[model samples]
Target: MTVSFRDSIALHANALSLREKRNEILASNIANAATPNFQARDFDFEAELARASGPAASQGSGVDATLGYRVPVNRSLDGNTVELSVEQMEFSENTLRYQTSLAFINRRISGLMTAIKGE
Candidate 1:
C-alpha cells in the first residue's frame, strides 16, 4: 500500500491559499471603503476550492480569474460598492476559517510525524 502525503493535505492546503487570498480581497475592500467608484471584489469559496483541487487546475493560480465584484445591499452616493460592515464581517469569517484550516493541517502533520517516528 502506498500513501500519498501531498494528496492527504492538498485540500486543506488549497483551502488555506484560497482563504488567504480571500483575506486580501476583503482587506483591500475595507481599505478602499472610502474611495469613490471602487468596486468590492470577492470569489466564491466553494467554487474556487473545487477548481483548485481539480486535476485541470493550475497550481497556485486562478483566484484572480474567479474574482467578481460584490453587489452592495445599498448603493452609495459616491459609487463605492464596498460596504465597511460587510467587508469587516467577511474578513473576520475568513480569518476564522483560515485558522481552522491551519489547525487541521498542523494536526495532520503532527500525526504523520508520529507515524514516521514509529512512536
Candidate 2:
C-alpha cells in the first residue's frame, strides 16, 4: 500500500489555510473597529472550503459572493460596520478552529509515521 500524505492531510491543511485567513480578517475588523466607514469582511468558511476541495478549484475565489461584510447588530454613529464584540468573538472562534486543524494534521502525520514504520 502507498501512503499519500497529501490526500491524508488535505482537509486539515486547507482548513488551516482558511482559518489563518479568517483570523487575519477578524483581526483586521477588530483593528478597524473605531475607524469610520470601515466595513468588516469575512468569507463563508464552509462554502469556501467546499469550493477549495473541488477538483478544478482555483486559488482565486474571484469576486464571488463568498466574501461579504458582516452586518452589525447595532449600527454605529461613525458608519463603521465592524462590531467590536462580534469581531472579537469571531477571532476567538477562528483561533480555536485553527488549533483544532493543527491537532488533526499532527495526528494524521503521526499515524502515517506509524504506518510507515511497519510496527
Winner by TM-score: 1
Candidate achieving the largest lDDT: 1
Query: What stretches of model 2 exceed 4 Å from their correct place?
Result: 1-3, 58-66
**Weakest ten-residue segment in model 2 by summed lDDT:** 58-67
lDDT of 1 by residue, 1-119 (tens): 77789878988998998999999989999999999999999989999888888888875564443899899999799999998999999999999999999999999999999999999
Model 2 lDDT per residue over 2-114, tens place:
64667778778888888888888899999998999899999999888777777767544422326698888888999999988888888999999999999999998998889
Cα-based RMSD of the predictions, in order?
Answer: 1.7, 2.9
State the local distance difference test value for candidate 2: 0.83
How does model 2 score by TM-score? 0.89
**Candidate 2: lDDT of 53?**
74
Q: List the residue pairs that clash in candidate 2.
A: none
lDDT, each prediction: 0.90, 0.83
Number of backbone collisions per candidate, in order? Answer: 0, 0
- TM-score, candidate 1, is 0.92
